[model samples]
Target chain A: MQFTSEQRLDDGVLEREFTLDGIPGVLWTPGSGSAPAPLILIGLPPLGLRKVYARVAARARYYAAEHGFAAATIELPGSGERPRWEAAEQARADLRRVMAAGEPVTDEIVDALVLPLVERAVPECQAALDALLSLPGIGGPVGYEGGVISIGVRLAAVEPRIAAAGLFAGSFVPAAIVEEARRVTVPLQVLLQWDDEANDRQAALNLFDAFGSAEKTLHANMGGHTGVPRFELEAGARFFARHLR
Target chain B: MQFTSEQRLDDGVLEREFTLDGIPGVLWTPGSGSAPAPLILIGLPPLGLRKVYARVAARARYYAAEHGFAAATIELPGSGERPRWEAAEQARADLRRVMAAGEPVTDEIVDALVLPLVERAVPECQAALDALLSLPGIGGPVGYEGGVISIGVRLAAVEPRIAAAGLFAGSFVPAAIVEEARRVTVPLQVLLQWDDEANDRQAALNLFDAFGSAEKTLHANMGGHTGVPRFELEAGARFFARHLR
Candidate 1:
């Protein structure tokens, strides 16, 4: 999963691509840094392409460059430029293909689809984790953080290698899954929004309680389920710096 | 003010009454500790009835007793069983009279008239604060914490005797007011919820950047509009215990 710092595109956005355990991913990496730094993976749920994710990805690239970290915003399987759903069954089968290929898909999908279909995709998520870990400079100890949903957090938590993990505006999975996720020993940060419609305050509270870590930090900010505002970035950055290292 | 343990109700479902500076209020304390606590001030905006206030008050009482803190649920001037309003202007007059009298009215009156007339009853809010601080154990160092809507926090902050103050989920106030509030040197904890609709997260961030106190601790939670969720009580309790004392 070695992400190369390549030149900006015609639109003046930096771009790069890499292959993780044979799964190729195009990365938008900022070029201002030379050292190997922390990497961020951008994922969107099964919804249509959202420009917000791109904007956030761009901001992440900027932050990574400014702070001297290697950042990669990748389009997940069946997302962004690779949308492959026409019928529901086709989408499920497509996801199964990705899972069979050993890409990392979150349990959210596994729980949503039939057992046979999920069984096929389980290895994909593992492979994705492997691909993510295989990226140059991403090895050793790594931290994963996300806010769109609980998918990313769940994915990161199951991987024993993620040293630290954080979730902002995350939804809660089934109680059993949450219980399993709580077993993750890494330092965990859960950020919740008060007025979020998709995942309301109660969901956040339940997730926080489920974590069962006395050291787990629960931050309540003013955003919906999207992302954090810019000014608040410093606090989040400080938290990440303080704990991730 | 010194709040005696006797003044505190039992953990199970219960009801009690209080007269703060002659303002009478019935506290409804619930038995189960599952519900989230509400800071039910009877005389605040969105006026309702005495029974409503009483129920909310009881809930607050129960919440405080169960959670080991105090709950202040008040009654407005004209909403509940106290009286009825002939018109908006009459309601205004009634509010003035209530504030001037400094007597506790039923939750009905407080909700219907008192809260709606807050801006005109600025002096009343101040007087209430004074009376509140005059209570047995409330004396020493009064601090305020709030978000974008900071009338309550501002009142608490400007008081010279307040030991410390913090604002979370807050919006920008007038410079003079902020300057005056900043003069109070106490440990401050500002929790900003980024991406809020009413008060932009960037604005809160900038305010935090310009605010006073080297002891200031800024945190970003994932929420909007309404303040942090109840689960944050863990952080809030720890913070207030450390600073308010």
Candidate 2:
């Protein structure tokens, strides 16, 4: 891991930009000279780091400032400045075409779009975890926070370092990913927007049910997509505190 | 309202047993003397107060000692040493018979069992609220927590003092009560036990969907009806603190 730039926020959080195996990412650590703060690995949607940076940074800062945790996120493959894959682009085009035609999005289209992404993203996240946990002041057990539900499911299922997960509920999950969800035994907190037009609520609920975790909670709130209430951020922090601390 | 007995808990919560217009109830207030603390009117299941007193009083003491909120609950009509009505008894018998025979519980049976209870309970609860709030140290914007969800829906719908509610999701809600739920505009937090064998999960979800409150949240946890995690008690306290304080 090679750090490209560094800056300190007013709240005493140290923000560092880094690249591991040519994949760009950012890490935030608490400032209190606490020997090693527990880490939270945030997951971003396919939206690039630059587009989601401000929002994700605010959450990272909250964790650092108020909750005393280190937080980090890496760009998903084929997003941000990373080169796009041909098959992924084709899948996106198909998805767009189906939605534009006002036809039902078939399972094939969803699988084509999400499965490959989850396949590539999960390994990259694990690699990033390896790099982050190796840092001097960042420690585990780590937590995984909101992003694409499929990727979060995969990571929580396979990654032993991740003791818990707080997932943002979304649709387009492939059947394979739902099956993978059954392997995730870590405690989970899932946030769902009740009226998210871009998502299917029942599918989200079903995915929540499929998790193998004995301790899982689904917090469904009234709103469209992008309307998760601010209070949930603190709730997520407390949840991680319970497990990670 | 007549005070039957009063005692100070070990945590400095003042617990008082009372009866209003011949109906029995209990109230707990913070001993801090921070005059006029906000209140939470706990709703009890119709199982009678003695049966549920220890559980509910623990919750009340939690509110008073930890959150600086007064809490109260009155026995439901035809329950807890109160006079039993034959109609409600018959409905209960019918309900048990159907469940024993593995027959689906029809809406008629549900309405018969719950509607009259709600009709009698809501008013008695309101009268209890009137007496409790009239006391010097307990104040409003009140919250209603748990118990029979239909009674909560009606109280939150028509009771102006009830600013928010935390409902324990249960079945047996009549369609009329479901419509009444749409009239409840207060912020709500509905707790659901996902694998509760006695309650219909889909019905709970649908009722959560029907609430008119723009600020409703559904917190679905894994477990059976009696298996709500202990952490949720604190979560419910924090929720009421957000709205009531």
Candidate 3:
């Protein structure tokens, strides 16, 4: 409810940057809201919610404004405005040592090191949803959206409130998510860049197959990381409109 | 190669146990060697070259005996007869800490911690090949085979000395292996139990797709990890026969 600043993007999307209940976030609502709008909860891209994801945020805004929805991006726990967890630093150090020795990043190391931070992140996402949904002019059904896509995967699996999901397959999936995917029955739209150099294409495909959703579609294009085609993004926005609108 | 014990497994397969060049191994050659025959380098199942993997070892022996090939199993650098790598334990402990905190195992963790151990394992495999090829009765083309499966994945990617590989898709894949898989042009037969609970099904399928080989066949059956039927094993043996014989 309390925004530190409010600005109008060139395209007329209303952007309000806020530190709601100690969680930092940016909310994009229509310049002229006439009724409660469907909400799109955007996860941080791999580069965090910074300049790198500006186009992403814009896309979310453009889609929402065009489709009569609201899009919001929050700082997950241990990221953005929040302080980094000590364990994350330790995990990074552990990773560096193993990489120096030319070892593969194994699951156990992921479970121990990176999992904790993301697990904590899940709750933070829930909190962001709570805060965003309660805003004066923000409303209607909510859909989980965006990349670093595993968090979206986790949210869709556990949060029954998520009416739909549009996932970007650009992150490593933990084994737990494979199990989680089996429990996710929500309608989903998973987009993948077929040849992302930094991504394990197999893992992405595996997570997509694990979804228990009968109404899931995988949209894949041959591109590297940061090379997701615009057509796919439109397809995803169209999907959310069908489900969430 | 010096033997410590020899046994006949009721099927005319001669099994010889030995500690050659500080590596513990079991060598199985058919009771009849009419001419110089092929050698199959069998990797260990998730269990070391221990009692649990005995049946697996036996299957290799039985196949080798029936098909007029020589099969041998060797303990990897960190399992069975070899001293454990100190770094692996530290990595495991690090993984435990993260998992205890309910973290999702991410790819970076695998790259840092597990890669070194598996990287070390690759050379040990080469060493085993060098030793196996040097034996009096062992001869002709060599096929690298085994599971938990990434070891086989890793070996197939790098060891051009291997004429053929029968990889079991029953383990998590590090991202590096996806890159490595591209380098594996060896004629390959990859086996998978389609419903393996402990295995990441997506990762398995992805690695299979990543292989650059034109002669690769995916032998997937509808079953759990331990439920791969006897017929599939035979099919794998048949593949080796076609490629390595």
Candidate 4:
């Protein structure tokens, strides 16, 4: 990991920008120089880091300033400054066409849109995890927080370092990912927007049901897609505090 | 309300056994002289107070000692040492018969089992609230937690003092009560036992969906009936703290 830029946030969190294997990412650590603090990997949707930077930074800062946990996130393969691939671009176009016509998003379209991203993103996150944990102050017993639900599911399923996951069930999940969720045994806290227009409620519920974790919890709040209440941020912090700490 | 017994728990929570009109109840308050603390009405299942005293006391004490909130509960009309009615007995028999025969618990049976209790219990709980809140140390902006969900839905709908409710969706819900849930606009945190043997999962999900509160949240945990994790008590206290405080 190579440091590119650095700034100290107002809340006393140390925000550092870095790149690992050509993938750009940011990391936040508590200001108090708490050595060996638990790490939380902030998963990003394909929306790119710059677009969601403010919201994502707020969450990372909350974890660092309020809970003394380190948090990091990397750009997805086909997003932001990363070079776009034909398959990913084609999938996005297909998704838009189906939605514009008000036709149902078929499983085929969903699989095409999400599967490849999951295939590539999970390893990048794991690689980022390897790099983040190797830093001077950040420590093990990591957590994964909201981004794309399928990527979170796949990472939590395969990554032993992820002691807990706080997932946002606000995206389209492929059927294969739903089945893969059964392999995840870490403690899980899933956030679901009850009236989310962009997501299928039953599919989210089914994914929650499919989790193999003995200590999984579903926190379904009443809202549209982007309307998760602010209090849930604290609730998610407490969930992580219980497991990651 | 007449005090029958008073005891200070080890953690300095004051537990008082009281009788209001002919109904027996218990109240717990923080040990220190903090007047007018927020109150939580502990809704009890039809099981007699004596039968669930240890568990009930633990919850009440948790609220009083941990959150400095006054907590109270009263025996249902046909429960504990109270007089029993033939209809309630018949409903109990019907419920047992259906369960033993592996038959579905129809809405008819659910109404028979719960509606009368709700009718009688809501008024009794309201009266308890009236008497409990009238006391010097207990205050308003009350929260209702657990017990029969239909009674909770009814009370939350009709009672103005209840600012929030933490409902356990473990009991059979009547169709009318499901409709009544739409009238409850208070912030709600509902608890669902995912694999509960006696509770219908779909019905619980539907009841959660039917609630009209704009800020409602559902916390579904992986457990059988009676297997709610101990940590949720603290979570419920935090929920009450958010609204009641």
| Highest lDDT scorer | 2
Best-to-worst order by DockQ is: 2, 4, 1, 3
lDDT of 1: 0.49
Q: Across residues A145-237, which tens digit of lDDT does each residue of candidate 3 receive?
A: 775566777788888779999887765466876787888888887776666787887787688778888667565555467777655565567
Give the Å shift of residue A64 in candidate 3.
2.9
Fnat values, one per model, are 0.10, 0.97, 0.00, 0.97
Measured against the true two-chain complex, the DockQ scores of the candidates, in the order shown, are 0.07, 0.92, 0.02, 0.91
How do the residues A148-213 of candidate 2 rate in per-residue lDDT, one tens digit apiece? 889999999888999999999999999999999999999999999999988998899999999999
TM-score of each: 0.45, 0.99, 0.50, 0.98
Ranking by lDDT: 2, 4, 3, 1
Candidate 1 residue lDDT tens string, B188-227: 6676654356565654555554545545555555456444
Q: Itemize residue pairs with steric clashes in candidate 2.
A: none
Model no. 3, DockQ: 0.02
Question: TM-score for chain A of every candidate model?
Answer: 0.68, 0.98, 0.92, 0.98
In the range B1-245, model 4's lDDT, one tens digit per residue, is 89999998899999999999999999999998656899999999889999989998999998888889999999988898999889999999998999899998888998899999999999999999888888998889999998889999999999999999999996688889999999999999999999888788998999999999999999999878989998899889989999998
Please give, for residues A1-245, the per-residue lDDT of candidate 4 as tens digits: 99999998789999999999999999999999646899999989889999999999999999999999999999999999999999999999999999999999999999999999999999999899888888899898999999999999999989899999999996579989999999999999999999998888998889999999999999999879999999999999999999986
**Candidate that scores best on DockQ:** 2
Candidate 3, residue A199: lDDT:
81
